[model samples]
Target: MFKSFNIRKKIYYLSDTIKRKNVSNHLKEINFILNNPESNKSKIIQKSNLNNILNHATNTTPFYKKFRNFDSILDFPVIKKLVIQDNFNEFQSYPHKDKNNFKVSTSGSTGVPFFLFQDEVKRNRNKADVLHFLKRSNYEVGHRLFYLGVRLNQKFSLKSLIQNVSLIDISKLTDKAIEDFLEKVAKDKNSNKILLGHVSAFETILKYLDRKNKDITNIKLNSIITNSEHLSVETKTKLENYFNTPALSRYSSEEAGIIAHQTIDSPDTFVVNHASYYIEVLNLNNNTPVKPGEIGRIVLTDLFNYAMPLIRYDTGDIAKTKVCDNGSIQFESVEGRKMDLVYDTQGNVLSSYVFNKIIYKHYKKIKQYQFIQQDKKEYEIKLNLQEDKFPFEKELISEVKEDFGKDANVNITYVNEIPPLASGKRRKVINNYNKNNSLINPALSKHESIT
Candidate 1:
């Protein structure tokens, strides 16, 4: 009657063992935090990890050595990606050791690149964190994943075979390729499959299906996770409608791994990766913690990344957040990048969601789009249409003028296809004018609507 050694658990343990990554303890610790988030054990583990990392970072690295006297994360300065670039060598754990250490890099949506050194413990913990989040999204240890990517030239490998991950390249997603992929999943109806990739790739698939009037209600996917780009609420509904399954948004980054994930029941609020990251939502102007439900900068203290030891690293992301009594961090919504934030003609602050609204309103006509604010009153829109005829060009211009200003110079250009960035993400909003990271607008109030 005591069935502790299940097949799934056996596979999980054996797989980790095969890789020589003893992540059982790490995974257990993560589960403990998730289940007993408000428990004393959870608080102690979080606090201890924070203190240990700070202590380790200060003791080992020259960069953090100055902050050695300061124990709390709040005492340290919140650093940006640029700060890491300037002090790359100083951040690494010195003494010319740690053979298990490795390097990782990311050229994010803004085309800005940053790198980090990760130790074996941090790598294993990241693996465990990803697994923990995926498990919450109906993913088991054995389910095959239909991965979407861009410009990735993948080949046959032992890991791919063992993991059952069919990496489909989205650099050029042909209709035939999509149909065949859907057929493969539908072919194995009982075996629950998973789909994970960029939000844009999923949109392309949906657009194709809609164009062809195809039905794929029999795919029987365990979960559909859109990541690597902003996953809008409207698009999530469309994906779920067609796939007939729970479509969730996975908010992750190259810097930290899985940050937060939306649950099936709570689609708006994301369940934070409390297992690995001690998250803080701070105001834009002031680097202090923001109140729950208020939008702020997502600064993370990586409890697991001991190699580089990132203390109070500003993630360059904005989000409305909530912290439950049990020490769980939930994001109401992960808004777009801090730089991608747009503005009105007179330089009034605008919610990035305004662009999403325009895209949603014109989904039927526009295949792909990019909004660029060139000058204070000059705006440009590049559109790849679903069809040749766009009869509402003037209406679109008028609508944009309403936001940018009635006398604003707004131009619209039709394109064959809006090309994805080098990072494979289609940046929907780009403010080329300036970077006003401050939440306060001296022109008027802190924020203003399109009206």
Candidate 2:
């Protein structure tokens, strides 16, 4: 049955490749560069593409017009989310035409929203890039993909069937909802299935399955790919162990289609998609390129999005980078956003994953939880309960106090709903202390201390 599904997927991809004029060629070119990362041709192609996009941005975009004659890409100032939010009109290279141009808004996970426009071709390229990456994981075009993320506005139709995606709304991630989703996957036993979504959503589902003692062997999955949030080692391990498959972490954003993905060869490190965008790790203070192995802010330049070229756009995430022996740019470790870390009373910093694991353990009753670190000593936890009254409220508080410290002021506020970020993303942990500290701080450089 799996063999038949694979054959059908292959046939569908081949037919679609023939129908699409230039998509196959684009995929081939990207694949070639990916296969030969160290080749001089690859470097030349990347440089040429970057230069072309930079030139286009300078000439056509109002935001970059002032830097038209900029001798070097570095000379141009870096644009932040606030700049894009305020001067949105200036960023557009051309006026939007219905159906021809696609408008997308960032999930405002950073508290500031950014609206972006892309040409139809660019949109197709984004989809192509995703397909190309999936192919590397031995995923065919028509394979079953369980997407546990936002509910797309489009209704189910032929296109949806062709895409072969089963959308599971992250908002409706209750225990019953997860059980139903699992049951549906169980029914389709033969199809090669892949789970893709935000890390928290997958974690929630995993916890639900674990709590119910569900036999994951009955619903086999080929791979698990998580994005939109930091995929921690613990979460990845849990996913891999439960699904009996490799869990791949994808680093991406709405502004940028897919910045990096963990390949089969390098499961620990994320290799940049050189064909789609150019990545640079720059110092947060001066925007200068940081040395290999040093942590720095991520800046990306979209090579394909000509409708609104985003050159040297600060991605707000911090990561360490190194040029591998094969000459590919690899992420050493992604610490996520500067404001994503919580500092405890002992001045020990904790990754957002620390609290996520604790909260998700009680996911059946706690529908949603947001940890807000007001300061080193004061903490506020807001929860959207599955029931009117939380039965384990005392246990939850005790567990939190144990981690935070006995003297710490940990307040629990029950709310009907926790507001999502501008990007419609619900952050598990929010560090209010670092909200205004945009620049990289020395404390954040230290590794996460659980105690």
Candidate 3:
């Protein structure tokens, strides 16, 4: 099966480049220092490694050359996704040999599809983040389940074949095929593995569970891990109700494996990977640190990636910080996305989190729902729910009206299934309202919001 094949492929990839110094060695070296944090040697190791990364990025990468006069960390300008996308090759340590590197393109779900080169060190750090997150979530690396996504490598190639356990292509979100795939996962015995994918893909599955009135509590699962897309509390509660498992939200990107993750012990707040990367929650007006517990934009400086350094890079999402009494950082909550917001003509901004909370509170029979803002103050609600309770659609409509206010136009539509975006993350709320003026302030980019 693919489990073994993936292992074999990794072995082969390593064998082919053994003389070039495998990524595993670097990981082991860094992990040793991270694990033994109490040792004085930790500081020595970290400073030495970071200095080397900075010098390498400055000397080899074209973009960094312009920053030769960079004085302090604050003096370095924020790197936007667009800037990186346009000059990806120039950002590389070996720009001319970009194709020779392991080039990987993102799913482009959030409207940015671009390629990134992953060197051995970056790859190992990425893997470490994933493994560390899985450990925190009470799951292992090789848990059994149908992994969903488009196969990147060739179909017959050993790499491609190994990546193909339960691969489902989801370029289109609204599809019967996607529903069928979910049904299989729900029924398959071999899938005690946690259901994992973008928020959109899992939303589709959750909708199916709601519509059929299926007892997801009966389904076997270790935990439900949501990534790529925002994990709204509404979706989290619905997923937990059906699957009878704790739903953990993970914040990650293709460029970085695990930025923040919810541990099995602490399902609420996401702990930053402080050892791997330095995370800062900055004010939108200035890159100053936000007051404790205040909402701000999430910026990152990846301490690991040397081929391309990201100093104070904007991640395009908003988050609030909550430092525990013990001084550990955790997120109080992450708004669905900075761009995903709805507003009314009167200028009252409705948060996706608010919609999700209201719906979950009022309608228990409702399975999965999506809120679409067609215009200021106009909206449509879509649902996929149980058969016997299908008649309860009217009640749900009334509930939305009650929560959104009486004047808000609300329409209820029934669909067999709901699909996710190309990135496989399901968008719970789609705002078509003009960006310039809305009941709420327009969503600011991570960097834009934070200065």
Candidate 4:
């Protein structure tokens, strides 16, 4: 009576006996966050969980031993990746959960990786959250999921395979690979199919498919989940139309498995995973949480990760938290990390997405554009254009200066091409002034060939 996977469902059982290894009660928790988050029962559950997590942290971890069980969770300091790494030993809880413990690291956004440990509960919760969202996009447990990546290191996953996930390395994606993937899609018509990939990887696939005039109408994709890079409106629409399915941008990180993700109706807004995490939006100046409309740090307190407790951990990303009339929590216009954040002359953080917003309109004329902050109040926009003439130069300069403050110096550099990194991804914005900005690469030139 031993089986590798769980798929059976019985009618009269009190509990679903046939359950997967990673399955948990997290589905109920996730639904509470997504649906009845403001209900009294939900509030009590959150309060109880928070208190328990805090007590566990205080009792077990060396870093939180200073704060007694009765101390407020807010009393704990907001931590970054650097802080954890410097005090790595202190964050670890006692009794270790040694057998079930596993190490996970943040490797994508910043080149420098920060390691943390998570027990089975945390891992199961992560899996459950992902499954919940996948279900929203019409994806089922046994559905075929294709994950495309840029310069992928690990090509295989046992858990992913168990969940029927096929990893397709799109680093140097060949015509044969595209054809093979599509052929599989064509073959599997009865079952639901999913594509989880980087925005760039999807773009490459779309371009290749378009070149060959590939008809994907019969491919029957259940959903397309784009991750890693930002999925622009144009990209999302194209993918959705081609596959005749929903294109959802998943807001996730290695530190926190599933932070937030786009819903079917509203592509822009992300529904925060408040079930597994207690999300706080804190302003740049003081550590206080900002108003719903204002931009601030997307701080998190993992409700489950007692193995390596992350209390008030600043994710370095900026977003506006919106509380709707429906009593649901949502994150809007979520931008890049703190390292890439734009700052005014007075060291006040401004929205770094200004450059991208301004340049997006002229994407046809301009092949690629990058906004670079060379020094304090000194910025340069490197433009790789399709045509020799650009009429918006002066207007764009003035607009950018206004956003950066009165003291901002803005200049435009026309280039033949904006060079891509070794991984073949181009950064839209960068801040070279701050050494703390982990994404900075001084050796990287603004342009491949100056015009």
- Whole-model lDDT per candidate: 0.78, 0.76, 0.65, 0.74
State candidate 1's TM-score.
0.91
CA RMSD (A), model 3: 5.4
The TM-score values for the models, in the order shown, are 0.91, 0.83, 0.74, 0.81
lDDT of 1 by residue, 112-209 (tens): 67788888888888888877777888876656778888767598875665556678888777888778777877895337578999888888888888
lDDT of 2: 0.76
Put down candidate 4 lDDT per residue, 1-451, tens digits, no spaces: 1122234112101132244443546776777656777888888888887888888888898988877744576667777788888888898998674657888976545555678999878887897788778777667666677778666656565555556667777766678888887787688644667888877777667767666888878887777898877777777887988888889999888777889888765567888877788888876555777888888778889998879988878787778888877777788767767678877767766667767666766655666688988878889999877678999988888878777777788989998976655445667788887644433221212211100
Which residue segments of model 4 deviate by more than 4 Å?
1-22, 150-162, 174-187, 206-215, 344-349, 362-369, 382-426, 434-451
Q: How do the residues 36-89 of candidate 2 rate in per-residue lDDT, one tens digit apiece? A: 988999889888988998988888878789888878777666667888778878
By TM-score, who's the top model here?
A: 1
Go through the candidates in order and give the clash count of each. Answer: 0, 4, 12, 0
RMSD of candidate 2 to the true fold? 5.6
Model 1: which ten-residue window has the lowest total lDDT?
442-451
Point to the candidate with the largest lDDT.
1
Report how far residue 191 has shifted in candidate 1, in Å.
1.5
Whole-structure CA lDDT of model 4: 0.74
| Better candidate number, 1 or 3, judged by lDDT | 1
